[model samples]
Target: MKQPNPERTPILLGQIDTDNHIATTVSLFVILLVVHRIGISVYRLYFHPLRKFPGPRYLAATELPYLYRNHLKGDWVRDMVGLHRKYGPVVRIAPNRLALDGSIGWPQVFAHRGANQDEYAKVRGFLFPGDHEAIIAAPRDVHRRQRRQLAHAFSDGALIEHEPLICHYVSLLVQQLAKRAENNELIDIVKWLNFTTFDIIGDLTFGESFHSLDNSEYHPWVLTIFETIKGSAMGRFFAAYPIVRPLVVLSMGADRIKKLQEHQIFSKEKARARMAAGAEPGRRDFMTYMLRDTRSGEKGLTTNEIEMNSPILITAGSETTATALSGFFFYLVQTPSAYDYLTKEIRSAFRNEDEINLRSTSSLQYLQGCIEETLRCYPPSAETPPRVSPGGEIDGRYVSSGTILSVYQWSTFRNPQNFRDPDSFRPERWLPTSHPLHDVRFDNDNRSAFKPFSAGTRDCIGKKLAYSEMRLIISRILFRFDYEIAESQDDWHTSQLVFVIWDKGPLKIKLKPRTMTE
Candidate 1:
């Protein structure tokens, strides 16, 4: 510093050169990466296997749009409808995914495997990221074994025995709502419906009730299940880029991961307890059938398998039934004539509250029609159930191997091609005979396109049980109380966040006890 040492000049210049070289190299590398990404995107848009399919440019080029719309915005179902409307029945939702809205694609993709036809299995991305493969999302071979064991638990005979237990819970709901009505409370009917269904499923599956209805709050495990779903929905956005998924999961922090692990541990312990104790001799629960061997003495599921499938059974059985019930009531209340008609149907059919049971409610045509219309209008699974082609043709379209094929349920159900005035609630469309308002448009609508439970081997196994729960709960509620919308919910169905299951908002309804007078 005193004299600017001449000896140090070369060293300083050399250091500067070295730093410049390093910076240049890094900049070059970044440039190459950006160039490569752009090249890939262009290829996807113009030369990829799905390039011929119609879709928005951004969605067809990269999955970022999908991630943004589905995970971040939580309105992918509505987005699907818009895409189908703009681009016709088949649209490229991703670089490799095709969403089908046409009627033929449903059976072609979801139908049972045949001798001449190729097999289509569930997409691997549907599986829970960190757990034993649950039966609902398992691969074909694993699913076959798991379904065989669990089928007995959900069998007609099993449901018959479970019916009494179901009735007991429905009775509790009726009593609870009556109390709420007496108190002049504005209740969240959706929450109560969820509590009722969850309690019944919890008792049946875990050998005890969650007591959500009794406690007037969600059980910790049920809350955990829903949080898990939200986390999962976010995780799926990264699933398209499998390489980054592990890092994304790790970044979710220790607290969330620990909570998820704790829930799994709790579920496993409960399942083990049920297996050890066995079911009551005359009255069977879910565990009883799961533990019992098939007629051929085929082995049942492993402890881990039963533990994994238990959560699925509980969530599927409870959440879906609750969604249908809440959605049905939402529409029923808005359509005063339909609501009056349905209430009359229920009240006239039941001589007393005790007389209402699954068997007795089965014959109510208007009740069934209301259920169907609700399912059509607000399906619990509003998004497409993606299927992967083993390699073959789907409705005359030759899709490349491993291409994702999905039928957008929301779009198809709402399509004018499937139902006339589809947005308007019309339960009469389900009646066997022509609706009095029928026209050529109504006659031509493809009713077969409305498959709420899906179809074939992968269809919802809990279909019959779901119907039973819906019928019993709705009838019992209508018979005991009359409800009015406590507040208006504009676009209730459209606003719901669907992440595997609907994250529903409160359906606030003011209830009044049904009075007998002319």
Candidate 2:
């Protein structure tokens, strides 16, 4: 071998030095990253503002545990029930978040603000795209404006005008169930309820029906709506972990994403078409009321605002009513005493099916009680949208600014402190003490805690409409047919996964036409 050259030796030494520098940099970088994480965790555990609150230390140290359990696992509603039981009314669920039971928490956190107080801002991360424009996700001032404009459509006077249209669809529902009853078929009551409610809301919002009830099957768009709602949980998860969103999107597949986009497009197009058609005189559809304000040159929603809000109105009006009714029947048929009592109440109250209108149905005390209990047990909007604190007290505990809190509806309604025999379905629990049906055991139950539609200025505006729909539909169905649970679907209600809204499967039942004795 030739003698080593001076230049070659220098180059080899230089290469070794460069490798050593790269290794040292990477080692230092990794060490810093680990140290940073540890420092943050320690801060969260020992020095965070929420450190005094009771909760799993891991959850308080990192949001990962809460996000993993609630969002990824789709078990937040069920999990909250256990969490509140273990940690009491106030629990630190994340480093910056607390879950409040609805009793004192609902009033303190969600009640109307005082003169000097600012509204607790909504947690933006919980919303889906386009939701910011809708009343549900609008900023405080924006929400007030939107609510004012939209309030007329849901007014008592407006609902009176819409009654005939509502009755028409309900009649169609009864007729459809009659056919299924004649066949002795196992009817998926959930699907039928969905069809009825979707058609009603579609007609009210679009000035056209989805024809789901007429077709005796779901419209493609209606099917897509359910898919979109289920996918919202995953969307919320991605929103929380934006760094992982790109990877999650890739795994979600293009078809699913495309379907969601198509649903949005469909809603936008329908809204546009409704706008172009112009309002029909004496027509009381939702658009007609919105157009009235716009045409009168009042501070009403813009054309774009109308389009943005149509999907919100449709989903809010339809899915929630359908869910409540589904839960109503699920609990009703299983509780034979409740079933018999309600059926008697309905039959005795109405001599002819035609007489069972919204007005007549409202007077059925037991029916009303049953509906109330159903709402308590299985609220349509089962989870509360998280609200950000503005550095105030909640349930007598001080919450720092930017802290996230929510009165989890599932936990509140099911809490033993709020109700007697909380897990059991007892309509009497909702009756007043003076009522013959009222149970003494539930006398001390925290009745104020039973806010299924929520409370305060931001409460659900469509509450009156929802109650009317549920009462009319359930009373009519029970009056027309005698039904039984087709299969042992005891877990049908509880087995669902909450994705903002419930991801409910089929509720199967068999119906027999009740003989009319004039």
Candidate 3:
């Protein structure tokens, strides 16, 4: 063996200082642990902190289940209910989150603002992240200002003025259906409903519609939005982590950002032109109302500002309405008796599609019930929107601030505690005067339990308009032709692409012409 070099050994020993390496490694780990611990503590004890309350373990800790379930599974809403059933009224879901399936009331929860707008603001689909004062993204004061400005357009008089406009589309829908029946082509009710809705909304709000009704397929943006929603639902799952979002957003494709920028630009330009005219559009529409109102106010919302919010209004107003219509028609086909009954009522009520105006459609009580039952069974949006607790006692239960809470229309509507034989489709359940469904708990009361259009300040702003559109469209369709689900059954239980979900596949139906013989 060669003699050892003492100097070399000492030099090597300098490199082997474990104390410094160990300290560096340990310090890095400690820092990571501290950061992680603080984050966890915030979610668990502060952010939507419901230490004493309960829900599914995964849900309480984060929106992972709520976000993932709808996108990932068909029975998402039901699964939450299942969790509710298993865990009781309040269940701790995540490290600190809670899901409360309250029965008596949850009014204050829906209305009050929590910690900040973070409760609902987490739902970014309403508007993009921006400094602009869009109605949905604006601070409370700005939202109030914007909403007040928008009120002129959604007013009853505005609605009546627009009655002819809506009626025109209803006729156009009838004509399109006639062509389909004549061609012996099967109808994808989902496509047409959205087509009509997008068209109507576009026309009524944006001064024009894509005229999707005339197309054999959906418009590109319609397809894009549907994808965006589905994408968002999936994104929401990862968003629960909070740390993952920045990395994901940075990696987003240039095309998506470009498209969003394009849409924003288009909305801005259109709104400016409308505002510059200093007159509402000649046609009765949302922009028209907005234009008229902007004149009265000293200052106007920037074009970009209105643009940010306009899409949301059209989306929220029509997408939900259209989904409700598609689902309603889907269920009606199964319930032939109810279908026949509604057909008889509408046909007897009106002579032609032209005769079926918004005012006329409003008179049909059974129609209203049919719409309600469909909404109750297959709510437009998969969920009622989650919120953070307002930090107070609601219905005698004390909830601290930052509690992640959601009021589910899906669960509330299907709940046996609220409705009799809740799963069954029963339109008569909502008859005005006398029905077996009546009870002190919900029915015969002004703000009752069967609220498909929720209640109070947070209630749907487009309720009346949605009601008019569904009634007229469905009424005319059912009256003119009868629809039956095809050999391949239509399924409403699909992974929700958007918060406002539709069936996985088209609602394929054989539309048979209704005549005296039939």
| Top candidate when judged by TM-score against the true structure | 2
Residue range 1-518, candidate 2, lDDT tens digits: 88999879989999999999999999999999999999999999999999999999998989987776666567877888898999899999999999889997668877888768888878773745867677887888788888888898899998898999999999999999999899999999999999999999998887789999999999988887887775666677777788997776687654555667778899899888888877663566888766665435774777777887898899999999999999999998879999988898899888898999989998888898999989888888888788888998876778999998878788899999899889888999877777788888888999888888777788889999999999999989989899888667989977887876778989999999999862
Model 1: pairs clashing at backbone N, Cα or C within 3 Å: none
Stretches of candidate 2 exceeding 4 Å from the true structure: 1-20, 250-254, 280-282, 294-297
Model 2 lowest lDDT segment of ten? 290-299
* After superposition, candidate 3 runs with Cα above 4 Å error: 1-49, 57-76, 102-106, 111-127, 137-139, 234-266, 293-297, 434-447, 494-504, 516-518
Q: Would you list the rank order by lDDT, best first?
A: 2, 1, 3
The residue-by-residue lDDT of candidate 1 on 1-518, one tens digit each, is 37877899999999999999999999999999999999999999988877887888988878887775776457777767777878887888888888887486677777777767667777764635533377777877788788877888778888898988999999988888888899999989988998899999999887789999889889888877766666666657766666766675676554554566666777777788888886453467788777777678875777777888887888788888899999998898888878888888889887888888999999988889889989988888876557887777665667888898878677888887678898988877776554443335455668878888887787888999999999998988888888888655856766787765577998888898977641
Best lDDT among the predictions, by candidate number: 2
lDDT of 3 by residue, 1-518 (tens): 99989889977777777667988999999999998966875666555436556444445455555555554343466665567667665656555345555353355555446545432332334234453356644555676677777777777988888877777877788888888888888888877888888888877777777778777567766665654554444455554656765564566544544555555555566556656655544665676555553555565555666667676776777778888887887788778778778888888887765677778888888888888889888888656545555466755677676655555667667666667777777787777766433433445323255566654445567788888888888877877887777775644444333343553457777787778444
